[model samples]
Target: MEAHTDIQTTQKGFRCTLCDVNLPNEPTVDAHVKGRKHQNLFRLRETRKRQVQNSVFVSGIKPNTLSTQLIEYFEQFGPVQDVIMDKEKGSYAIVEFEEQASTAAALHRTEHVMNGLKLRIKPRESKEFKVVLKKKQDGKNSQVNLDALSQELCRAASVNEQMLRVVESFQLNENERNGRELLVKLLQEVFMEFLPDCEIVPFGSTVNTFGVHSCDMDLFLDLEKTRTFQARSKTASEPTGEGQSEDGRSEDSILSDIDLTTATPAEVLELVAAVLRKCVPGVHKVQALPTARLPVVKFSHRNLNLHGDISIKNRLALRNTRFLQLCSELDSRLRPLVFTVRFWAKQKQLAGNPFGGGPLLNNYALTLMVMFFLQNRDPPVLPSVDQLKNMACEEEECVIEGWDCTFPSQPIAVPPSKNTEDLCTLLAAFFSFYATFDFSASVLRDKSFQRECADAEKYCRSLQYQRKSSKGKSWGLVRLFAPSCPTGAGAGGRQGQGEGKERHLELSLPFRLAALPDAVQRRLGTAGERFREQWFAMVRLAVETVFQEVLGCSPAQEEEFEGQMDTSTSSDAVAMDTAKEPEEVGGHDQTEGVAAPSGSSGGVVSPQAGQKRPFASAETSPVSPQEKRQKLCAAEDEEEDEGAEPAPSASWCWLQRHPVWAGRRKVRRDLLKARGVTGGGSAEASQPDGGGVEMELQVTRHITAKEPDPHDLVAFKVGAQVVGGSENTRAVLRFTPLCDQKGHFQDFFHFLEIFLPKTTEAFLGK
Candidate 1:
């Protein structure tokens, strides 16, 4: 009877219980629930429920109440999630429980007595959360929900799928894109009003389409048209009797006091900043970074919650941005790979600058490295920048800051890649390629000498007559990263350490010479020896070049130091320092002035004018820890000795966090103790401390004292293995750990596999 009286289940309207609102139809009800007000109320209801579900807000907590005591008391209710104390407001705290039932049970009592004081209990309030978009300072990171991303990646089907998922998660959403676009349009309109003919163009990640959700917007203030307009206006207003004002200025001109041509870059930037601060609505945090590599007016848009920079003379950044965009558009694989590598680098802590003001391999550098790899692959996956330039139309030809930046603007202009490899295989290959690459050299294969006309007439010409073509052919002539040729265990290796000499000979000896008939050996005699030496010299040069240059053991030495590039700055429009060459970390090659070849007795053994001079003390005898520290400190303190030959740069072997190298002293001690040697200074010294291994220890100890940088001491020397060559030469590995401690070494070594090459490259300022 009650059901019959009340039953109106088939009502025309639907209702929202949380908002306490009714609607006309189901669709209207759906719309109402999804509407802003309804959503807010729904959020509030959920937040309130969540706060009360598993948490009890205590109104009277003692200031001295320990988290341990809270846990002890709260355990009576149920397992505690966390206890958040509101210390500043009052002696209060919110004790969160693992179960809602426990929270409700605890609340049923409604009151409690502790420390002889009564306390009132309620539900904790949920704090509001907001997305904070911030500029990346040198050592700080903006807040990101990376844990959610990690979980998403964990659920991905494959590494390929994971990479794509990561990109999809981070890529700018439609709302963000629309926000940036609107801001760009508004800024452009304002700028055009001030300069009349100026065009505000977005570049960098913002326009590159590879932009992540919170990447900074880079705008190029194209004042070329404005400048042209200004020149014409000046010509037309040249004290004309009809249209000139009494001040001899154009009547329509607002820029009478500002001479666009004569104004310094800093002045222009300041002017831009002034205009933005005064006239542009929603634009704030206006600043002029005149001393920045690319002088720009940086600002934030209140409406968009976005940061941006406006530059007047950064054409290079524009070109670079276009190039990146083209690459992204051409290959679906490029962006995903870049995103994966970048995230991996960030995760492993290999990519952040340590606030000491040295270069880290930024996203730009990483992108270039990937491009180089693709261009170099067999049946190449991507065309060279030079090839792109060649395909560019006449109208597309561009020169910025004396560097040709010509490349096809459209992805369609680029020919499809011959490489049909899947994303998973390519990703695996990328890691594998870098793992074995020689970082001490350029990644580009050396331009091979080609005989344009291989005829009888050209046969008599000297090797010097075979000219190297004007730099780039397949790629852009300018190498993105050009490290020094690989020295390998050659010029970079330490020598004269007893058996080291024999190892060197073993490595350098020609295999052919060992098998030559005795009669032939006798007949050739000294000439044969010279021939063998020459062959070894050639082999060393060839091998080292292949390892260092082609393999990328070291990071490429950049042709010029561009200074610290602002992430917000456009890559194409950045004013390149074309004249200022990078000061090489390894300095000028010592072998440059050597007259003899590498394998000659005179050349290999003796010091040359520019070559690294072997230290008699270091080469002939072992260096004590004290002496080593003194030398390192002195070297670190002293300015670059411009006149003196550069010393051989110390090589580092990276290991993951393992007790292996750290346990060296213990291992040595144990070995000593096992030999029944105890309580003597000699016992410590007698622990199989081979020369190469001892040298590595000395290097680590000294460098550690000198730099005191955590990163510089990442790897330690545990032992050495003689990489035997021949009777004359050998290379030594001064830091080989005993074994992988579980998978710790493998996991750590994977990072090193990426890190060492990058470290070498970064040291060279590639």
Candidate 2:
């Protein structure tokens, strides 16, 4: 009797269906229904119901299995809201989750073994699912199981394994391809009503077989067929009285009025954009890029969440896309290797969609490089385009936009490659090949010109430095003696030590530092000691940052010592003379504005600005050479007393682990001289002929005092060329090393090099 009463209570007791709240009496139920809490719960239930509308459908449920058991088992993934079963038609169930993510996750588990039966799991069917997007289509799913794939990739031991995992995670599955095809067909049907005979072709990554998840779909609208149809219409007597198209749309359409032969690409794109916005059901965000290399109308499908573009002029791109697809099909290894290299470059911030269209390499360019490397591999992993072209039959020969586009249509037409390198080995080799690559020698416009000039000078210097005695100084020292170290016998050593070290090798020697001339030491006085200490510190930092960190070489160690290099200046007269002060360049007059800002690139005046010789006094001789030299010396002494310091031309903080800036000064001097102008003269002195001649001579002598590191903290003043010729100013670069020797601070330096100059220019309103 108690059991019967419990059953009756469960059947008829008052309960809030929306919140699943039980009420003991009718009055309590009425109050709960009218409460704000119940209203909020009702809204939440509606949202959950909408989310599970895209639930996972399960089939092959056993007769003994109940809905409660199904819910309990699946709820481990997420909260299961409902489990609707129908055993009469078939043992099937729709398992709904409170979240859409759960549905997406469940779709990845294609087969689930439950109660000795293998059940097929898929997305619940909807009327629009086939026409739009299906979580699972034809047994393969649309979304990747990222958690599982990420775990697998993390566990991968080699680059080869990681690359393969990346490919598996990112590649388009057969079902996705089929869905894209269906979408293309649906679009074709809609376009046919307007274009009558136009053809829509898929291109780019979508069909190139290197597609990643969510990559944009590229489509080409071929209007050539429309021209052929129009020609037929003109030749016919009545043209079929403007009948309806196959899809039953009007034959007289806005697109029909367009003459493809004469219509501008922009006009056609705008027309497409208008059609997509007004006529297409799911298309949104319709935009036209008329000024693109190939004008296109871009749009996104609401239901599918897929972005696409339609182009009127991209036939060459289509051919290239086909070629890439063929190359990918020829070998299974190509796709994985390309994907891995692209991923690495992106991780390194070396490539991306650059701002203002800077020189950042795109994915296509990287892919080509990979393909080229493979083709040039030992035993040849893939055949070259020329080889593929030669394999084509007469009918298979093709040309587009006056360039050969011929290649074997099928993979079986070409013989299989004999190269057997594994993915891991290939990936490792790819990095090793690029890390040591001298891109300046092989690519970049400026590098090519620099190389040509360097080679000529190098050959001449090598002949000059040919050894007089084998037991004498090594070629390393011989090259150092040369002005630019342009030589061959010492080329190997210079390459090993780097150009910067080649410049500093003699000066940095302990013997050379100890044997500093007395006259030079006296001239520098107290500043000389401070200068030496700073120079040593700069060299240490360079070695730590460049060699130890970048090259993975053992760091050269130095012993600490207190030497006689220290010289303290206590005399007020000497302090007053040597103290640094801001000085103007042309004339030490009050008329000059703030001194020109310095940078790695150029000064206040650009290289393109038409400039006359700054030393105009050289052309007119008022005094003899000796008397003029005396006057110039006297003027320099007076300026020294006035506490004038040389205005720095430019300053830079370089972060390359190599010595790229080693030979830059030489290039700058040569470049200035080539334009028939001295590189370092002030507007008032150091003229082309003989003006400010004394200052120029002193500068030459000082620059040759000892080879110097540009990074050393030294103050620049109005003087002759100190380091590089043709500069009237001295460089006072200060090098302060941070304690983090292993490159914790190197990133900040790199970031500065990239952005600091641009920011400086922006601040100056350049």
Best by TM-score: 1
Query: Across residues 665-727, which tens digit of lDDT does each residue of candidate 1 receive?
Result: 444455445667753556344433221233324433433343333321122221111121233
Q: For model 2, how does the per-residue alpha-carbon lDDT over 289-336 read when each residue is reduced to its tens digit?
A: 985545789898876677899998789999899889888889999999
TM-scores for all predictions: 0.44, 0.43
Question: Alpha-carbon error at 688 in model 2, in Å?
Answer: 36
Alpha-carbon lDDT of model 1: 0.50
TM-score of 1: 0.44
lDDT of 1 at 702: 37
RMSD of each: 25.5, 24.1
